[model samples]
Target: MKVKLTIKLLISMIIVYYITMTVYVVLNLVIYNSNITFGEKVFSVSFNISKFMEPYIEDLEKGNDFSLDDNNINKLTQNNIWIQVLDKENKEVYEVNKPENIPNSYLTAELIEFIQDPWGSSAPTTISTNNIAKGNENYTLLIGFPIDKIFRFKMTLTDESFKYHISIIIFSLILMTIVAYIFSRNLVKPMVSVVEDIDDLKNGIYINKKNKQGIFKEVSKNINNLSLILKENELQRKEADKAKEEWIANISHDLKTPLSSIKGYAELLKGDQYEINIEEAKRYGTAILDNSNYIQELVNDLSLVYKLKNKVLPIKFKEENLINLLQESIIDLLNNSKYSNKEINFNYYDDNIILDCDKKYLKRAINNFIINSLEHNSKDTIVIVSVLKKENNINIIIEDNGYGIKEEDFKNIFTRYYRGVNTSSAYNGSGLGMAIAKEVIDCHDGVINIESEVGLGTKIIIVLKN
Candidate 1:
């Protein structure tokens, strides 16, 4: 990965460098070929002046008095150039197209000043100087151009200085390349690790939580959080699957027991070898009916739970007296011979606590809670059901002094098909009672909370909007 990233970065840098150098070279070519009369190109013209005046110098050496031909003179005039030749006495020996302010003679110091600041003269001009030698005689030639026509910029460099600057440039580029590599490595390393982490997540491997640094810190944190969520979801899925298996097994057993009884009773009645009395036959028939009723109840509970979970159950809401509903539910439970021995009490301050609810389902939900308390405890255990009005809401409280729910079962108390650890083996319930109760309360936009201890018993509070 590092090698590939390094190669990619190097390629990118090379591309950038190539483009920059290409632009620089193209710009230089354009400037060199253009007809601009300033900068270094114009400075090159000053060097060419020596060659332009070479023929005149030869003529002067041959005693031609520095005379110019028509072609050469035309060239000088078209370029706006003036020429002056001076002898050892600093007197002008030959001149052409000289300006009106030009002096015929010059002092050495004045000539030096003019050379230093060519534009400082009254009739300013850019000047170029050349020396001419003919045997023992010597002369100075001055070529002058119009002021501002040529820009004079002087730069000097020795071999050592040039090499030093080149070395510095090379070193700077190397250092920058190293820095870029390090920076990219820092960025890419984390990116690669994150990719690997995602791949692991895809394979169902969760990452351990840890602190991360650099720009990818947030990304790492989010990935870790996702892993934790996914891990938790996986655990929940497993638990649900295990619960489903157990529920199916329990249902099979519960159904088989009643079905076997039903089959045995019907077979016994149909057997011709057995002389059954009318009372015995009636008892057998009743037993079969009871088992069938139990199976029907289990199937109905399962169906209702499914409807509630899928939000397919329709509820018809109407105004009902909450206290009267509780009283009726308690009375109905007491009427049942099974729960007639259970010591249950009902208490309420208000006789008319009104609420919007589905009467049948709401009563079923309340009865499930009361029955749960009765079935899970001793017959003598005191079960108290109370209704209270608090402001604009109604609270129904069910308290029981019985074998309370275990701590481990609290989390899954309202979960469908989740039987508690302390549930009796003889109590062959569908395990949807509490879950249905909670769902029904939720359907009414109410909240139900349970508090329980190992021995002190359990308290369930149902709060509803008035």
Candidate 2:
């Protein structure tokens, strides 16, 4: 029924109390019975004394010299004994040292009369009489004693005994409760550890590396191993996603080259102004070469992406002069087929801007942005590249006069396979360039962000620690 610890302890204590009380009552009954038996023994001795004293009375009537020993009488009455004796007139003739504090009363009168009367039909077995005939007359010698002293002794013993018994019960209960509390905590300790581990798992924190040992130790170890398995699965999923993006990019580039080559050669075959001559053949040949170069470039870029994902690429990070690196990157972009003819605007503040990074990946990231801007924009639109040095970081902003991204789609532009609204129908590149750039920058502990408006131009901002 899911009882709480405190409640269970209380119930146990109550049961102990009742059991203790029952034992106490039984003990009192045994003690009282013993006192009753002792009372009967004392009464029997008094009866025998009365019988022995009757013979002395008979000798007194015969004028025999009686040497009564007072010491013997004193011993007989010293049991807190109250003896009553009566003569022929039904009068109290002898009353042994009864307490005066009791005050002479009708109880004495009733006791004397009852004694003087013949040991009647209503004789108590606990009291007795002897008839002593001296010469001729009949005299009833009645003797009786009050057992109240014995009763008082019993009461005193019972009161003291009851107090000690009750104390023992109380002390036992208190001690038991303390012992029970310690025992319960020990029993629940392992469960508490398990609960804490489960809470950590729920919060996505690492489990304890220590090997578990307890009643539930096996379960705990199993859960810990399961967490490791789940983490490995998550890592594998990310790797698969990166590989899928690389495959799509390679396939797009491959298809675009053949398609471009076919279109270009077919156009040259149909001469525009010149006649079908050797010049047309050379033009067609050049178009075929351009397509083949495009295919080669696509294959190389795809291979590089694969190496980056697989950690097979030898990315050596060294302190590089930022000015020279950016300058070479711009030259390469200008010499590229897609960006060479575009109107490019460059802004740079010449300084000893140094960075610790792989120069190849950095260049690829910048090249992708430059070529993307030139190819996606309308004919002859200007692409601006600017590098700004801040106090603790460097900011590189690449702005293009092409249509910017929509507000709803801005956040996901760097995601692999995401094609923004501004993408032209003739765009030949895969949608992984920005995603790859973002990943590279992340590995360098840097950030890349994009700010754009629907109709205005888009700006890509890269920030790296100085």
Candidate 3:
């Protein structure tokens, strides 16, 4: 039979107590059988009995008119005490019971030798005193107490006291047993419940918040925390799985679309036997080049996505004057022919802001934002770039007065491969630009957010710690 821990502990304690109590009782039995008790050792029997008969002993000692009364003699004999007196001739002068264990006459020297080795000759069952001399040496007194008789009397008194002592011991045992049971139950129950909860978790059964409290509350909290972490991981796993499938589908369609165009235009250019118009051939050549560049962009965006996500791409960080970095980025963007027809503006404070950032990655992110504005908006739109110190933070604000984004597409704007509903094909762009830009800013510990409304304008703001 499988025994529970509580039962086992309770049984073990009971057995221990039983063994202890048995040892106690057996030790007491051994002591009583040996005709010894703590009381006898502490106060000799003669002292006790002499106190009860003190007046009589004192009178005898003074040689006064003292003789054992019949009643007193009877009391002494009943209590196993025998008294005797002898003269110088060694003949008994007075005696009680005249115990047969000793001779009626004794030489003083012989009595002295006997006293030294009294128990040697399987001595009298009684404890005896050697001769005690009278002042004139005319008489000697002797007394004896029987060993068995003394133990009998001692047992009677002990039986009387055992009533209270035994009661207390028994009560203590019962109380201790109850306490042991309760302590064992309290200790084991919570652990058992926690183990059960852990088993449930192992079986994929979720434990509710309500289950996360007990005597072992810290263990419960850790288990609950494990559940929370697992739940989060499960959610992230599902998201990554969905994103993977979508990415594959999008990449396949996007790759084939440009490749099919390039192939068709190249075939058209290859068939020049019909004397194709020069302008028409040049147009086909342009189409092929555009498709090829778009394909290359797709490949590059995909590569950046994985590299940034894993943080394997190295970032070189350095302290830079924020104003100087912004001016440099603006100059590089102005040199681009794509934004030649677009209006650009810069506004900043005269006070320089110091920041730690990866200049290359930061410039790449800002370039994406500017390119997005130019490609997604109408020509001649005014794009404003501003830098301002907000408290302890630096704000790099990019605002474009251009055709704003549709509200529904805002949530997916930064998602990889998410091309908005109105994205243009003029730049042969991949939908990964904003996603890559967001990753770059995030890696730099910066914040980038966009605000826009349909037909109004779009604002892109980047906040950096100073």
Cα TM-score per model: 0.70, 0.45, 0.56
Q: How do all the candidates rank in terms of lDDT, highest first?
A: 1, 3, 2
Ranked by TM-score, the better of candidates 1 and 3 is: 1
Stretches of candidate 3 off by over 4 Å are 1-189, 203-207, 211-213, 271-278, 318-343, 349-357, 372-382, 389-393, 401-431, 443-445, 449-458
**TM-score: the better of candidates 1 and 2:** 1
Q: Weakest 10 consecutive residues, lDDT, candidate 1?
A: 38-47
Which 10 consecutive residues of model 3 have the lowest summed lDDT? 148-157
Off by over 4 Å in 2: 1-278, 407-409
Q: Judge candidate 3 at residue 253 and give its lDDT.
A: 77
Higher-ranked by lDDT: 2 or 3: 3
Q: Which digits, one per residue and each the tens of the lDDT, describe model 1 over residues 1-466? A: 6568766876687678779999999877775565445554334423455555687666666653567777767767777888888888888988889988989889988886776688777767878888877668799988788766664656688999999999999999889788777876777788778888888899999877674788889988999999999999999999888888899998999999999999999999999999999999999999999999999999899999999999998999999988788888999999987778778898888787788899999999999998888777766789999888888888899999988987668888887888775653377888899999999999999999899997889999999987
lDDT of 2: 0.65
The prediction achieving the highest lDDT against the true structure is 1
Q: What are the per-model numbers of colliding residue pairs? A: 0, 0, 0
All predictions: root-mean-square deviation over Cα? 9.1, 18.0, 13.3
TM-score-wise, the better of 2 and 3 is: 3
Q: What ranking emerges by TM-score with the best candidate at the front?
A: 1, 3, 2
lDDT by residue (tens digit), candidate 3, 314-378 = 88889988788878888887876655656888898765788899888888888888888877877
